[model samples]
Target: MKKLFRKILKYGLYTLLALFISLNLFVILSGRFYLYKGIANTYLVGESGPTIYDLDVFAYSTLEKGQGEDLILAQNYNKQKLSAADRAFMESMETKAFLVFKGDSLIHEEYWDTHDKSTVSNSFSVAKTVVALLISIAVEEGKITSIDEPVATYIPEFKNGGREIITIRHLLSMSSGLDWEESGKNPLSDNAESYYGSDLYGLVTRQKLITQPGETFNYQSGNSQLLGFILEKATGKSVTKYAEEKLWKKIGASHDAYWSLDKEGGAEKAFCCMYATARDYARIGQLILNKGKHKGEQIFPMWFYHEMISPSALNTADGIKNSRYGLHIWTYMAKSGQVNYCRGIKGQYIITVPGEDLLIVRLGSEREANITLDPARKGDKNYIESVRNKVGHASCLFHYLRMARTLTK
Candidate 1:
């Protein structure tokens, strides 16, 4: 009886060991561990993915220097006069950096938690706007014939996948009808695959169509990846190379920037992963305010710049109520006028308020949702209720805009 019991126990232990080995081998061989590693590092383990503020931290080609001067800060401007309540509010948001520019002079600049002027953090989806800017440069340089041209014109493999109908404009406006389940919780979703996988082209190209192109507003990171592929093909240069030559080099950037790639010497992960300083991001806002001309040179066409910030007829036709999206940029209707901005998840903003001649940049680690803010006041009850229902990030955006208005005031 004792011998029989020992045999049973031995077989059970052997089976458990086999399962463990098999799982580890599968993770290593399939390369799906990249996704888990990324998630673990960024979300679970609380390690920020990459930093390249002061110097290039990733494999990158250089942006040649243009004969332009670094942006100057105001000498007499109020630099440290935030009320205690306001300072508490900003601190509660886990803000890393906050910058305000009135006209061409930086007014207020502050950083928290060891983040200085030279600290670099991931821009998250704000990089999408950078890609949009690059697309405009491509069009202006005649690398791309027109935004209305079908994407398949550059990416021939997409011609037969019912993706032929997708256009450069569709991708820019994020109306591409690709089948991407953009769930942060689902590792198998397209967002995770593009974020962590090595083969950006293969992952994006395999997606099937779900809706008619240019019909409605659908936000998908894969759309940006597809746009990156098109940009690469159209210019015969990687997105980073094109950006360096056309935009970054001309902008008088204060420091070298980094865009994370899928792997070493692989395509850039264009949907996200641009690491730049807060001041440099402010330069992008200034460039947009100047109508794409930087330092007496036309970096991107003025018409394309206008189209990037202007709300589209398609957005209106689709009955997108209270929407602010426009050609990969976000818009806010202030009483002074409309404000165009680029935003990233977890509270990164490059806001351009042309009406006030203002640019506000905020970068942070963790973002506070409206629901997580102070107890709902009587006036903010509806907003609180909406946040409770997970409607959107309206409250956080409103928070930033309110803070920016103080600068103008």
Candidate 2:
């Protein structure tokens, strides 16, 4: 009887080892190990856990700092030190850096988790808004005709799979209607594969159309990836190069930024993963606050900037009763729906309130909580649905906005 039990245990152990080996082999061959490495470096906190900004994964394209003036820096200029509650709230969310701007001055700056002004981190989906800015510039420069132009005009590969119907505007507004299951938890989902996959252009171009384009709002990262491809084809320059020449160099960014490529010398991940410091990210918000002008130079056309902040008619018609989405930019509608910002997973934010002439930036490694759904608010349906499609919750956004109000006041 004892021999029979030992034999059963031995077989069980063998089966477990074989399963482990098979899983590792699949991850290695399929390039899904990026998901594992990303989680280990970003989420895991301890001595051996590396910072998200410092991850040495794919090849990166560096955005060199041009001969631009540094930002006007300040600390506790307007408000007192962060209250114990506010400080605890920010720290509890694992905040790495926080900065606030009123008009053109940096009024508050704080750092936690051994991160400082110079430390850079992955901006994640916030980079999507940056991509939107680039597309607007491309249109302004006549590299592309218009935002309403068909995406297939640039990438003929998109002429099939019912993708020819999608316009550049639709992609910018996250209304591509691609048949993508963007699940971070599911390794087989498009979101995970895009993050971990080696072939971004191939993965994005092959996506099947789930619904007609320009219909309803469905936030998918594939839209931005495809847009990146189109932008590259339209401008005859890589996404990184155009951004460096047009936006980054013009903005007077302090530190060198890096955009992770799908592979060495491959396409940039326009949907996500632009590594930059909180200070430089704030500069982006400042541009928006200044109506796409930097040092008296009209960077992005005022009309394009207006469209960026405006709510889409399609969004409103689709029963999306919130001021929560714009042209790749996120919006919050309090005090007459006048807030625009860029948000990222794991608590990265670049919030701008034009009315207040205020900008707030927060970068963090840990997500705080799921979204606080308010049944009383009509917009929460679409807002929560959009949040459900992302990698993390919307709870941090509320906290960030609340913090911004306090700081700005």
Candidate 3:
């Protein structure tokens, strides 16, 4: 018995040591050690560069304005129960910041020692949805003829790899049927390595098509990156510059937004890596919820807004297995009804319930393991699923808030 116990203890210690080393190595290799700390405030200019503000000053100054109808205090809500699971999950994950906004008000916000509002959190695939918005704008402007047009007409590089038949619509809906994978945290994977390396755009564009375009649904970040390339080719401007001029400035966004650039600085990633403050992120959500109208201006064409929420061709039976995909958006049909969202890796989300006149944004670390794994795999699962679940729950909170309003009336 003593011998058996000694062996078990020795193995346990070895396992623990291995896990610690693996985690440290993962962090170092991923270049996550340099991310900013704490949630800071920022000012957005229509066509000007972003001006960052200190969190402490912004919080105190904004609080003095006396919580307006648009602003909500974090202390008022019962977050202890509402977000207990999410909080615990975040503690376990390598989350640097978390923020939630309801309507035009910030309901809850928190940041780690290494992250702040001023620190730009990586957007991951959320940038795809933003690119969709740009495409819609371009279509309305008549820069790109239409979604039905073959993507090869705009970007010739796609002509060789059975990509000539793909349509702009296919890329928008993630139905490009391209052969690519985005296994998060897999260093051997293209996306995980590109996060720290250079020329991510070239890496993605060089991939070949696996299935006939519009025949199947494949979640490929490369498809979205191709869309970025097409947009730049069509408009004669970079995605970042175009977005700042048309959308960011017009929306009255109170902060500057930043987009991660490729090695050559020619391609701004449209599939991922956009950073903005919680309030500003919510403002973008509000614009979508209001059907791309802000302060009585039709910032985005109404037809574009309609297509953004409505199902696209790729979401049909012949496309991807998940029939809930819209134009770079995810459609969630629950017992209550249908809601559309823009989701990012590591649990970033912007959920819009049009019928409910609600919008919710939840940003945090990955939490998949917390919700999907059994006891043994829980620690290693990275907690992404759990954070995603919290995003869903956070949307429900908006429903409850509406219910409370009705009851008070």
- Listed in order, each prediction's TM-score against the native is 0.83, 0.87, 0.68
Question: What are the per-residue Cα lDDT tens digits for candidate 1 across 1-409?
Answer: 9999999999999999998798678777986776565555455655554222312433434444456457787884655467787789889878889888888888888889889988777888888999998988888888899999898898877898788888989888877878877764476677767776678888888888888887777778888888888899999998888888888878988777778787778998788778788888888888988888877888888898888887654543223342456788976655558888887767788888887888889898556552243343535766544443222344666666677668657
- Rank candidates, lDDT, best first: 2, 1, 3
lDDT of 1 at 294: 79
Best candidate according to TM-score:
2
Looking at model 1, residue 313 earns an lDDT score of: 45
| Local distance difference test, each candidate | 0.76, 0.80, 0.63
Q: For model 2, how does the per-residue alpha-carbon lDDT over 191-301 read when each residue is reduced to its tens digit?
A: 766776678988887888887777677778898888889889999999999999999999999888999887888889888889988889998999999999998999989
Clashing pairs in 2: 333-337
lDDT of 3 by residue, 309-396 (tens): 7655543332123435678887765446667777776666777777666666655654343122244544553553433323223343
Residue-level error in angstroms, candidate 2, position 196: 1.7
**Best by the lDDT measure:** 2
Please report how far candidate 2 places residue 222 from its true position, in Å.
0.4
Model 3, which residues run further than 4 Å from truth?
A: 1-117, 313-321, 369-409
RMSD of each: 5.5, 4.4, 10.9
